[model samples]
Target: MVVVGAGLSGIAAAHYLRSECPQERFVILEGRDAIGGTWDLFRYPGIRSDSDMFTLGYTFRPWTSDAAIADGAAIRDYIRATAREEGVLPQIRFGHRVTSANWDPATARWNVEAEREGQALRLTCRFLFFCSGYYDYEQGYDPAWPGRESFAGRIVHPQHWPADLDYANQQVVVIGSGATAITLLPSLAAKAAHVTMLQRSPSYIIALPARDAIGRALQAVLPRKAAYRLIRWKNILLSSALFQFSRRRPAAMRNWLVRQAQARFGPTVQQRDLQPRYDPWDQRLCIAPDADVFRAVHSGRASIVTEQVARFVPQGVELASGRVLPADLVVTATGLKLKLLGGARITIDGQPLQVTDALSYKGMMLSGLPNLAMAMGYTNASWTLKCELIARQVCRMLNHIRRQGLDVCVPVLDTDAGQTRPALDLSSGYIQRASGELPRQGSRKPWRIYQNYLLDLFSLNLAPLRDGALRFARRGETPR
Candidate 1:
């Protein structure tokens, strides 16, 4: 077995595979020197999760940190600890970047070509699992604007945040409305002389902390397992109910959310920039602790400008509204472009696989692929939870294959009756732009991503292994 990426999903998959298939040979090929993928890469001041650690942490491992919303360093430590505890660290080969993979029909194995420390190496494995994340690790989105090179001011991207770059007593302009932009503004306001959040459009903002004091008090009194379970279910239920209510009655939800923002920012800020034109939940709501961003604006530490960037000048960014915001530094937190399946060139029997042409089986396995699976998580919920579930399912499938003497399992999508629209209906720039590359969900039970943990826990975890959509074949059987 060959698992690419030493991140959360990859580590989890490797741990499960080791336990389930002790006799089989397994290797983890990680491109970077470190084990934690995202947590290792993204290091910025006040870097923490948008979601609470209760739902974000692994199901098998409980996060007993004093802070429910863990910082990047804490998350990285957690991953390392988990890997060490599970004893999967020894099997990992760090700095081995997989270049390409080809399947030999005669051998019934994958010929994987990778580079480690500038030397080429090859490995053959019966199964291949891609847990490498979606974004481009090589380079994040940093587009060049006209006269950008002439700009004498400092420019930075959150993806590649410089360690020595200081924002103290400097005028900063953050250009973007995504999570990164929202997160940085409040933190910068504490030190920067003035901060301006320039956005092309507004996104829905919601306030939450690591954990509420009330939640903490209740947890202290309740039993450990019972407290974790109750909190998990409460969040799941509340989030689901609120999302459903918003979708059904958008106007009411929008009005209520707007009023909440108004109450936080008062009349002046509400009149100027607090109100958003689009409906609530149209895009992902940017989460902040205790409405921190609103409070920062109310205290006159930060301000927002709703306009498009016409171009970048030597001094600062010029807006379409004919306003030139002077800035000593500019940080573009625009967004990321989705690269499907870590930009892997997947082929089966000499034919390349187009992701859009394929259909998703159980939202993890794809059609027309043998002994191959990829993990894609929910945008609505914590990503790691869904990923952990998929990893367990993959382990179960591998175990079943070994016991049944099966060599290949291919998910077959009947295009005539099976094709349907996507599951998520959000206007995120990344999602909207890359809709063509995303996998198509089925109209029926197993193929859809319900975003409900209860449904997925039963369907993906407890369900039987034999499904008509997945076709299993023996070693000598030919492709039909």
Candidate 2:
């Protein structure tokens, strides 16, 4: 088996493959030189976990750190430490970017093609797991404005932050109101003369504590593993409850969230900058640890402007309202361009597999692809929650196939599979932009991609692997 990444998802998959199926041999192919995926790639200021570390970290490993919302460097170290401690570090082949994978039904194997230092590298594996992230690393979603070249100030995208670019005492203006823009405002305000966040619309923002006091107390009284489990579950349940509340009572949730922000910032700031047009959970809520963003605004170090950009002038951004926001540096923290399977092309035999044509079975494997599983995370909760479930399910599938003497297992969707929708349930701009390019999800069991963790825990881990939709067979024989 081959894993296409050394990130959190890949590490989780490797752990399950080693412990759950010790007899199976596996290798991890990493595109970059490091182990951490997103954490390693993004080097911008205030790069931290958007979700709490308790749920984002691996289930097997304990995040003993005091900070629940950890920085990018800490998360990167944690990933490296996990890979090192599990002895999977040596199994990772760095600088190996997988370009294409072809599944041969005759041999029931995937002929993986990759590039290593400008050289072609090929290998065959019975199972192929895609743990790479959903976004295109080579490019982020930097929308073309009217006058990009007219800006005299330095323009930098968060995806490709220049190490040498200094913002000390420099006026900075960050575009977009997503997680990246939220995290950057406070960090940049600390050094920059002034920081301004320009956004087309606002998102729901909730401030949480930087450290987990309850987790610390639990660790002091209980065993390490026990404490970790309790803390993890507490977070999981609380998040799920919040999500349900947001969905069931959108108006109430919106009011409560706005009130919370009003407490952190003044009523004026809350109404002007924090209140979103859409209801809560319409998209993923942005987490502001320790009320850093609120503090930045309250201290008059940073300001938020919700308006349409007319164009980039020589000194700053000219808005549609005829107001110009001056800046010495423009950081576009907009969002990522969604790309499936890390921009790697997937095919069945010689026929191209357009993901948009198939349904995502169990949120792990595709409808027409066999012997392959992808680690796509949830849009509502911590990413690793879904990734971990997918890994454990992959292990179970492998074990079941071996026990049943089966060589291939593919999900077959019938014509009456029922109504279908986009793979992701979010209304975010990035998801909406990739509307017709992504896969679909059915309205029925094992085919619908539930965003709830508890629901997936049962549907993925506890449910029967021999679900009728997942067909199995021996090589050269008709699928059963």
Candidate 3:
């Protein structure tokens, strides 16, 4: 088995693979030299998980920290520690960027091509697990503005924040209303002369405490592992309830969210700046730890401008309403560009695999793809909530295959499965932009990604392996 990436998902996959299939040899391949994936790559002002730590952390590994909302460095260290403890770090090939993978039916193996430095390397594995995240780390999504070249100020994307670039005492303008923009406001406002968050539309932002008091209380009485388990489940239930509430009663949830912000920002904060144009959960809700963004806004250190950018001038962005916001620095938090399997080219039996043409099977494996699985977290809930389940499911499937003496297992979509939907139901700009490039999801069970953790818990983790959609075969035999 070969796992790609050394980040949270990869590490979790490695840990599960080692424990479940101890006799099987495997290796983890990471493109970057570092151990952490997104946590390591993103070094913005205040990089942190939008989800609570308990749910985000792996089920096997308990997050011991007090901060439910941990910073990027802490998350990175946690993953690194897990890798070290699992003893999989030594098996990882850093700097190896997988470019292409081709599965050979005759040999029942994948011929993988990867690049290191300027040279190419090759390897073959029976099973491949892609844990590389769904975005490009080299560059973030930065749209070409009409007059971006004319701007004299330093422009930086959060994905590529410079280490030496000093923004202290400089007027800064951050464009976007996503999690990235919300995180940057509080952090940058502490030192920058003034920070302004400019957004074309509002996003639902909720403030959560940095520390989990209930979790802390549980830790004081129960065993560390027990407390963690309790807290994790509690969070899962709460997150699910919130998502269900948003779906069933969007108007009420929207009002509650706006009121929550109003309590923090007082009456002066405009409704248009906090009230989203779309329903809650349509796009992800931004988290403001301890109401930090609101505190910054109320303190006059930061401000929010709800408007579209007309063009870039020498000073700052000129609003479509003819308002010029003067700034010494500009940060584009415009969101990420989604990539399927980290943009790696895949082929099976000399036939090119167009991901968009394939149906997503259980959101982990693609239709008719043998011995392959990907770790993609839930868009509606904590990523690790679904990722941990995926890791466990892959491990279970691999063990079952080994026990059954099967060489290939592929999820074959039935033509009668009914209508297909977009792979993701997200209305986020990033997801919508990449809709044509991602795989499609069927309208029925096992062939569609339910997105709900509870439903996925049964389908991916506990469901019977011999589902009608999945086909298995021996090394020399064709799948029946």
Candidate 4:
């Protein structure tokens, strides 16, 4: 068995795989020198998770910290500890980047090629699990603006935040309105002379820090398992109710959210820039604590510029509305480009697999693929929850194969109905651009990815192993 990636999801998958199949030979391949993939990579100022740590942290291991919103270092430490405690570190091979993988129908195994420390290596395995996350770790979205090179000022992407770059007392212009933009604005406001958030469009912003007095009290009183369960359920319910309410009665949700934003900015600042045109939840809502960004704006530390970038001038940026914003630094928080299965080049019997042409089975397995599965999490909820459930299901499938002497398990999608589904309803440019390459969820159970945790838990974790859609057969039992 082979696992690609050594991040939280990858480590979790390996941990579970070890527990279930202790005698099986397996190895984890990580491209980086260390574990904690995203946590180690992203080191921007004020970097932290948008979601609460309770739900974001693993269920098997509880996060016993006072701060619900943990910094990058803390999260990194937690992941490292989990890996060490679970004995997953010994099975990982660092500095290994998988280039491509091919399936051999005759041997019923995968032949994977990887580059490790500038040398090519090959491995054969019966199962290949990909946990390499969605974003491009090498280079973030650095769009080719007209005069990006001509700009005399320093420019940076959040993905590669310089360790020694100074922003003190300098005017900073942050480009984009996604989570990174919102996070950067508040932190930069305290040190920079002034910060301007340039947005092509508005994003839904909500405010709630991870740690509150109430949350701490609950954690102290309840057992670790019970507390984690309570917080997970709480977040799931709260997020779902808000999302459903926004969808059902968008006007009301929009008005309430806007009013909250206005209240944070006070009447004067509200008139200038607190109003957003689109309905609430039209895009993924940005979360903060008590409208922190709005407060920064009201305090005259930060401001928002709602205009398209006409071009990049030597001094700064020119707007489409015939305005120019001068800055000493420009941070492009534009967005990410989603890559299907971490851009792994996949082929079966010498035929390449175009992700866009394939249909998803149970949002995990791809159609026409045998004995292979990928972990894809929810866009609406914490990624770890979905990943853990999928890991469990994969284990069950593996167990069934071992018990029944089966060499292959394939998930076949029903194409006879002539129906299709969209991968996501997000308006983010990255998601929109890569929608074709992404997988679609089914309308029925097991195939559908219910963003809700309780429903997915019952369907994925607790459900019976035998299902009609999934086909398990011994070698030579089915025609290849």
Candidate 5:
């Protein structure tokens, strides 16, 4: 077996592989020299998880920190500690970026090719598991705004933030309306002369308490794992309820969210800058821990501009309305680019297989692909929640194959009167941009991807193995 990343998802996959598939041996391949994945890659100011750490943390390992929204450094340390504790550190091969993977049907093995530095390395495994995230590690999604090359101020993308670039007392402009921009506003305002969040339109932003009072109280009274389990369920239920409410009653949820933000931002904030054109959960909601962003805006340290960028001026950005805002530094807090399989070229029996050409099987395995699984998380909740479920399911499948003397397992895509839908339900800018690249989902069970945790838990975690969608076969025989 082979795991494609050594990040949070990969690490979780490793733990499950070791615990459930004990008879199998596997190796973890990481593209970077570090282990934390997103936590290690992102080095911008106030880099933290949008979701609470309790739910984001692994199911086996309980998160002990009082801070629900943990910083990047702490999260990185936690991942490292988890890996070390689980004995997964030594299995990681750093600087080995997988470039191509070809599965041979005759031998039921995957011939994987990767690059380390300037040299090429190859390996073979029975099963290929891709735990690498969806984001493109090479670069973020930065639009080629006009006059960008003519700008005199320093332009930086948050994905590749400079280590020594200081913004002390310098006016900074962050361009985007997503979570990155929302997080940067409060953090940069602390040191910058003035910070402005320039967005074309508003996004639903909510403030969650950094400290979990109920969790703390529960932990103090109950046993270790028991308390953690209770809090995790509580969070899962609340988050799921909120998402369902937003989808069922968009207007009521929008008004309630606006009122929540207003209560934090005080009476002076304008609705144009706070309320989004779309309903809550249309795109994933941005979180402002402890109302920090609203406090910064209320204190006059940061401001919001709801306008489209026409071009870049010598000193700053020129708006569509001919308004020019001065800035010493420009941080493009634009969203990430979706890169599936870590930009690897996949082939089956020497034939090419693009991700877009296949359908996602239960959001893990792809249709017509043998002995492969991907670790993708939930958009509406903590990413780790869905990733953990995927890891567990992969382990279950591995055990089933070993017990039944099967060599391969693949999900068969079922068509419903030739109808199909996009895999993701979000109407976010990034998702819409990558519509052509992402796969489609089936209309019914074992093919449809329900973002709800409860649904996924029942299907992937507790459901029977023989679902009629996931097919199995021997090495020489074709998957039924």
Candidate 6:
């Protein structure tokens, strides 16, 4: 088996594979020289998990930290610690980026090619697991604005923050209302003379305490393992309920969210910037830990400006509303560009695999794709909540294949059985931007990907492996 990536998903895959299939030989190929993929790469101000650590942490290992929302360094260290303690670190090949993979039906193995230190390398594996996340790492989504070259001030994207860049007592403007923008507001405001969050549209912002009060209290009375399990389930159930409530009663959810925001940021900020045009959960809600962003706004260190950008001038950005915002630095917390399967070229039996033409099977494996699985997380909840479930299901399928003496397994999509829909149901900018590039999901069971945790728990973890859509075959016997 070959696992691509060393990030949270990759680590989870490695941990599960080692525990379930101890006899199987596997290697984790990481493109970067670090163990933590996103956590190690992103080094901007106030980098932390958008989801609580209870769900984000591995199922096998409990998150002992008191912080519900952990910082980038802390998450990175947690991943490294897991790798070291679980003996997966020695199996990792850092700086090895998978370039292409070709599947041979005759051999029932994949000829994987990777680039390491400017040299090409090859390896063969019976099963290919794609743990590489669905985003471009080198470059984030930064659209070209008119007169961009005319701006003399420093412009930095959060994905590529400079090491020695200083903004103390300098005017700064952030150009987005997403999670990154919300996180950056207070962190930048601490040192900068003033920080401005300029957005064309508002986003629902909810205030969550930095520490988990209930979790901490539970730990005091219950055993460590028991407390962890309790908190994990609590978060999972609460998140699931909230998501369902948002869909069932969007107006109520919207009103409740607005009231929460108004209470933290007061009516002025709520009316001017916090109240989004769309209903709650239209896009993923941004979580503000300890109301820091609101505190910054109230303290006059940070302010919100709602307007469209006209263009960049010599010193700063010019608004479409005929107003100019002066700034010594501009941070484009724009977004990420999607790159499925780590942007690797895939060919089966010398035939190129068109990902867009394929339908998603159980949101983990692609249609007509054999012995391959991708760990994609929930859009509504913590990412690892879905990823851990995917790992378990993949392990179960692998074991089933071994027991049945099957050489390969692939999902067969029958168009007549179900209707096709967009891969993701979310209206987020990032998801919509890459909708055409991603695989489609079917309307029926197993084919459709549900955002609800409880629904996915039954569908992904409990469903039988021998579903009608899945085709199994022996070596040298390809299913037609």
Model 3: ten consecutive residues of lowest lDDT: 412-421
* lDDT, candidate 5, 95-201, per-residue tens: 99999999999999999999999899999999999999887999999999999998998999999999999999999999998999988999999999999999988
Supply the TM-score for candidate 2.
Answer: 0.98
Please provide, for model 6 over 315-348, each residue's C-alpha lDDT reduced to its tens digit, 9 standing for 90 to 100: 8999998799999999999899999999999999
Taken over the whole model, the C-alpha lDDT of each candidate is 0.78, 0.90, 0.90, 0.80, 0.91, 0.90
lDDT of 2 at 267: 48
Off by over 4 Å in 3: none
Error of 6 at 161 (Å): 0.7
Q: Residue pairs in steric clash, candidate 6?
A: none
User: Candidate 2 deviates by what RMSD?
Assistant: 1.2
lDDT of 3 at 250: 96
TM-score of each: 0.94, 0.98, 0.98, 0.95, 0.98, 0.98
Supply every candidate's count of residue pairs whose N, Cα or C atoms clash at under 3 angstroms. Answer: 0, 0, 0, 2, 0, 0
lDDT of 1: 0.78
Per-residue lDDT of candidate 4, residues 1-480 (tens digit) = 898888978988987898877766789999899889889999988888777777778888877675667778898999899999998888999999988898888888889999987899999988888888777788887788888888889999999999999999998999998889998999999999999999887776777765756567778899867876777677778777887898889989887877776677675343435456677765777887556787788789898887889888888998998798999999999887776566678999778986766667766787778777887777776778788888888888888889877888887665441456765656677877777777665667556656677787887778776666678777656722
* Worst 10-residue lDDT window, candidate 6: 266-275
Evaluated against the true structure, the overall lDDT of model 4 is: 0.80
TM-score of 5: 0.98
